[model samples]
Target chain A: MRKLREMLDKADINQFRFWTQIFFFALFIYGGWWALNWSERLPVFACAFVQDRCGSCYLLGLQHQMTAPVSRMFSLAGLGILTGFLTFLIWFVLLNKAWCGYACPLGTLQDWITKIRSGIGVRRSQYSETGFKRLKRIKYALLILLILIPLAIGNTIFGSGLSHEFEIPFCMICPGRTVLPIFNADFSQLMIDFSTSTKMILTALGMAVTGGFFVGAFVKKRFFCLFCPMSALQYLLSRLSVLRLVKDGGKCTRCNNCVQVCDVGIRQIAENMEKGDILQDDCMLCLKCVAACPENDCLQLKFLNIPVFRSTDTGFFCRMEKKERGI
Target chain B: MASEEQSRMAQSIRMHLAMETEDVLGRISMDEAPQAMGYFYRKLRQFFQQPEGLGHFDKPGIGTFCAQVPLELIEAAGARPVRLCMAAGIWDQAGGELLPAKSCSVVKAMAGMAASQLFFSGVCAVVAPTTCDGKKKCADLIETMGIAVHRLEMPPSKLSRAARNYWRESVETFMAQLQGWTKQKITRKSLHTAIHRRLMATEQFRRLCRLQTKGVLRAVDYFLVTQTGFFDDVEAWTLALSDLCAELEARVAEGRGIEKQNRPRMLLTGSPVLFPNIKVPLWIEQAGGPIVTDELCSATDMFHDAPAYDETCLHDMVSALCDRYLSPCVCACLSPNPDRIRKMISLCRQARVDGVVYQTFSGCLSYAMERNAVAKALADEKLPLLYIETDAGFEDQGQLSTRIDAFIESVQAKRRNF
Candidate 1:
């Protein structure tokens, strides 16, 4: 450990290094994206016989299973299920937001491009914490609605309840695939083949979802965070995340120094405070606060007691270091 | 017999004028120059002899400031601070004199004084914040002729840290500019002394506000307290204050303080309520209501209740003053934060008000902006809220009557619940 510390004493990591790590993380993400690409990727539980699709499979990137490209290569349906659960565990436990932070192909590409094309001044919506936070819940709610009540009109005289089927929402909505198509696959045919009823549903869903994103991006940049219920899901489960933002408030000067580097605009510590070396929601657990913190060793990315990153979380490491010494 | 009658009337007039002149002379400090003294004497004589209704100070929404401005701040600044109050005995004289019956009675009374040329013109300046949409416009209308109407933009933000900074800055700006305008380096010693001296005026004002002895404040005597508008002498406005306070104190001591009327306690807000307005007060009284005090910024008696601090303590003084009578709800142009509404309603509760009549104006940004929060607050309190929308000139009373009747009924129902 001493040797590791001595080795990196002179190192000054910069944005380029962070960008380099993001590139590797994307390749790593391909492992899970590959599994969902398979056809006959039958869900394991009673859900398969009872319902056609599962939320986890949709999460695993199973847009369509029958014509899935990876299915032609791999025969076993269980392998796809196995691969997805493994990926969820890896991402959920080890690097909760690693997919969003470093590995998400779309996110990485966006970051790289954004770095190069930097003239887009922050939109007014990004600055209004109260306004933007209030609006972000709509997206996560849509995700839950899209998955949980898929194709079901809730119980009534004309009852059509939640459909347990793959939502055509992604095909109808995600412009990201067009910009950077995954697997070099064309989704246009899949989009056109959906029945008229499905098309209307898709179109309505598309208008709501797209309008929300565009409006969020333009009006209050990242308005999605305020209403996106999935972020809340991620936030609730973020306690299990290895990477977390830790604040050494004793060292904090109340100068509001770390707020600018944060993509999400949480100004005060209480609103932005997290337990470990990485922030919870809106953090992407990217160690932005660590980099932005002016106070020495005020923020850190720690693995157990080890300082994986030279962050503000290190003082607590040293404090623990002293307690162990006392023992 | 005609000669005898004329002679007797002349004697009575002479005696009244003499008593009024003595009252004025006694109140003036010896430090005042002969001209200022003479001005005081003339003002007293004219007011007593003619007693033209002091309606300018009695405008709708004006009662809020009239109740707050410490008479000492006015007098020491060499200004006469009036109560701008109403529901006094002079309503018959001042009411409907200039303002139409449909107009806000408080506004009508003020218009009466303006039409009668009683008070608003003979003043150095008027001081109050933009307490409400109606009052702000009225004060602006009265701001010409170097009248220097100072409108403090009372803080409108939440009561958090960010809001506090904004309010402090506003307070600094208002007090500093006012210091420059008043031509008196209003020091801590001066302001503090003025606050201490204002205990006398407060005591006096409390006397008239008492529901005893005179049944209610005679509109004529209410006119005197509201004359904090006429001059800028903090120390000298106590002549009438002394007389009124003495009479009320004596009455109270003699067990004369009894409930002559069982009018409902109402929190009058929105317009600059002037005294002697027959419409608003009369309507309130008809509806079994009597306005105790109100939440107005200009010409409401809030200034008197404010505690004076050391002048140098800018932020502390501002925080105190900002919270004194001007809460975030005062600046209804901004969304009245839930906390602001909660605070204002709590104040209503403290004042033991049975109902709130928030006078909103069409196209006025402040009241309209705060309308939702104020509504939500009233809903929370379960208090009946009457939102009266009026024009800048309180010109439409027929439009307000049915709504008023309904609101009064709602309050009566709530009282029954209690």
Candidate 2:
């Protein structure tokens, strides 16, 4: 057991996280697509088994399909949607928003871009606190539009013929819908849809969002993850996650190690003195803060109150040794 | 005669001769040292002269510099605590190779001693505090020599409760590491015993400082008694100091003091003046002014406060140790170090000194930067203050003597005006 621990200590966890991101990115976008008949039942999200769909956006599409021929009235899902929400909830709680840190292909690609920029000796851009606060509000607005636009189309509140353009509204502009399908050798998304001027404009907007955010991700760490609507949805279920990052504020030296290492630039991890449940909304649960903290038991990765890898003075120095080696 | 027995006897005799030569050389080099220091040298010589095979009582020793290290914790872990200080000599060449030219001589001398295995021989570990940049890098340099250095880090500022808890945990972690190294358990009972032992020594030191201020004790005796405690056993040193304090009390009642000619009393503050590195104190005494009290880490500042003991709890005692030691330290490591100036003023008021000598080592920036604040505080009290920056070597003696003599004259003139 001790030798196993020594081996694990030698293994670079951040690099391990990088490979995990690649595996999930492959599995979600391209895994078993050729052989499987699991399309209609599969829930839609950027990370779900099906491509070109999102769970929330799919809920909107299902809402549209179910209510299109009836009177103008909003309708909710039956048993299948309930089961899909449960499945998504299970995956969401298992890693929490580690989906953002270690699984999101977009976030992973952004990190890769950051690495490339760092390789070319370019410094990162940091947003001021107020500016970052303003940026944070964008994702919630996107999340609200993702819900409201589909509801408007299902009820014909925005009028009947607008369904072609307004159904799956965020997916029309989502970079993931355009960018992720290419890994499966799908390039049909890149072409602008010419069905209507509105469809052309939505496809054009998708292309623009993809191009802008990819460049933004290259220059800033986790740039697109900051404004991801999916991340905003995941945070609503964050409190139920059993896999948690805990902080012993009494032991924390306010060293700013956690903040310095956080991909999302979380200040609460360092500045918080209150003891219970510091799993803040912006936390990716990357546990980079755990790796960086020098104090013993100061920051911890706990799964249902059992420690997996907690912070240690030796582990901190070991991570530093690995960082130096990487440099 | 048995041939193997005869050869073994011959080897033992040769080893003894080498030990004797080292002692003689150390004494001859420090032959110009004060009588009290020579007395301490002889006691240390006797203590270090024990043969091997002494059993668990002679556990592996851990050497450290700053008084912030809780020696009792080291004791509870079953390791002997040895205080590492700047040894007297011009042995700078080896340390000069390792340390930057701008580094303080005390750290340089420490590097020299560790490099040669001179004063630092037979030590299992060294605990060095990051009190200054020079000291921090000195710890690193010593670690390069394969000496295990446990760097006891303190917060840059001690104003917050978080900083206090951080320091307390750091001390606890250090104690745990020591326990692992020594294969001993640091029980609550043992920690209490250790705290009790140190409190006794602290009481004796307090009395010693009190006597020195009252002009009942000589300045050389004050420096010697406290400095020698760095090497002496805590119990024996306390008893020795208690006895001396009693003798001095009798002498004071009889109106007997070493000074036939009245010297101006000055409070010594700033960089530590270890034995053999006693040029500053030696100069002050020789120039018709005696240091009545000191704010140095090695002197009265270390003993100013005893740890607040809670007999039933180990964590409380550890917190008390952190509070007592880290709180009063005037080291520049703590920013906006107003506590230091406050401590100096309070000690000066009690000691009733005519002037304050704010001493700084050449590379010790923390104490060096405090010159303005110390000067301002002393000026407000209308007390004369002299700033002296020197190194470990004797090359600065002539210049230092001239400044001390002038400061003494000015302080005397100020007294005459009064």
Candidate 3:
């Protein structure tokens, strides 16, 4: 068992992450052909827009459930929302933010775009510290709008009610709805809806976001993840999750190696010395920090507080040596 | 290549260095000392007595004055890195003639060596990190002696984002300069291999440190083992350290380690204590206080941290190297550096140290200014600290020894009362 753990700790994490991402991407994008269904409350971005998707993202179901009349929001109708959330939490706690790192189809697509950018010798862009701080708040703001906009559609707010087109306000602008279905030869969502000005504006906004997603992801890694409301919601309950990223402050040298390689550019993982649980709001639990840390046991990927993959000098050197040998 | 006058001066300095080296070696050689220690002793003797035989002469040597200059880049550029910080009083006097009366002894010695044409004999260029005022001036002094000097500007504070970016750019610029000098592009494969080589040495160094903390290795022996890396080949030094660690492990298993159980264990910090000038450490050991660990750049801090790049790409690797060299450095030269106190407290706890012996040279303004802050922090942790201010000369040896002995006595008495 110890030997197995040593092997895992020194394993090629990039290769492991790549294969795991491919498996989940295939399962979510084409699993319906095999009659596989993992419930509509799945935590990751297995888009509902994909006609043959095995599971749908929880955000869509959440917006729909929250659209019930405000008068019956706390009644028996509300119990359905409660049950859906409970199921979503159960699935979320199993892997935590790894849903974004390894399972999310949208995230996988961004990673592929980034790979292409690097393959062509184009330099990737990164946010400055001030820019990162300011942009990180967008996700929380979107989370608020996603929740309140749906509720406002069901009830009066400021002496007015929103149209049904704004019922799933976030999903209306989310690039996933416009991009994911293309894998299934479904590009009908690409056109603007002219039934009403509200529908036309929302659908046009979605198309523009899809175009931005391609160009943005090509230049920056995990661009859409910066404003992902689902990530904000997961962070609110991140403490209840079983998987964690832990840091031993005394062992950390604040080398910023983790910061340089982070997909979401979470600087707290390297700079925060007072915090042991280093899972920041933007952390995708990608375990790249754990692999980059040179100090022994400085950063760890823990399942229920038991280290599954730890950073060690031997492990760090072995990985680099393998890279040098092109193995 | 040496003139008659320069050769005579080199002969005189070599004689004094050899005597000082033999004196320390004689004191460190004990029956309980590990057989692997002989390798380090021979390496040190060669460094002082036979400078030309230190090897690596096939490649152009790059002289570095501080640890901030990444050695991996130098090696990757197909050049050898020779750390030029000296602690001998002979070189200090020789260099004192050119500098002010109250200059840092380490830099003075380096300038003296450069003046004599003894140290920078075959070095093609020098990479000098402006860590302190003394080093910056020393770079200028070395440049005047006709050796090319590449000055690496260090940021005053590493806490700000601007500083971090500036440091990254500075390191990248230094990489370009080195490549230009060596006429060899630092390819990703070469840099990766260089980083791996250093990591291998770091593994062995950490093992040696663990043994030192366990009281299996003497303080002087540990210092010698690390100081040898300044002139020795990285691979050779790592192999010798590994052999020493294996022997120390066996001795620990046999319960044949240093028997200083009753003495107070000490953690040495502050300015670096190099070879032939390790008076404070020698005094601490002779006074029955064993130095379990140290936080000196000349020793533990030199190889303690290794770069950990997440990707194999050149850009990420260079950025990682910059972070590794800058962020973790607890040198007093960097301002608002609370990391030094935290590191000291942590090292104290890990080594089970009863007191800290902070040594700063008389002219080392940076370290001397940090003495009060370090003292207050250690006192808050209820750990006794003894701060010593002296130069490279032996005029104050008796006074320094008395103070070390008294501090150890007080620590032992405190333990007894508890």
RMSD of each: 20.1, 18.4, 2.7
Instruction: Compute each candidate's TM-score over C-alphas.
Output: 0.37, 0.52, 0.93
lDDT of 1 by residue, A123-215 (tens): 242345565465556656655654443223222212533332334344354433232332334334223334566665665565565455544
Q: In model 1, state the lDDT of residue A103.
A: 41
Q: Candidate 3, residues B158-269: lDDT per residue as tens digits?
A: 8888888888888888999999999999988888888888888988998888898887787888888888888677888899999999998998887775565667889999
Clashing pairs for predicted structure model 2, backbone only: A44-A54, A44-A55
Supply the TM-score of chain A against the true chain A for every candidate structure: 0.63, 0.86, 0.97
Candidate 2 off by > 4 Å = A1-327, B1-41, B44-57, B258-262
> How far out, in Å, is residue B309 in model 1?
4.1
The best-first sequence of candidates by lDDT reads: 3, 2, 1
List clash counts for every candidate, in order: 104, 2, 0
Tell me how many residue pairs clash in candidate 3: 0
Please give, for residues A56-96, the per-residue lDDT of candidate 2 as tens digits. Answer: 22333443444343343323535555565676677677787
Error of 1 at B192 (Å): 2.8
- Chain B TM-score, candidates in order: 0.55, 0.87, 0.96
Candidate number with greatest TM-score: 3
Candidate 1 scores an iRMS of: 20.4
Q: Write the per-residue lDDT of candidate 3 for residues A182-205, one digit (tens) a residue.
A: 899999888899999999999999
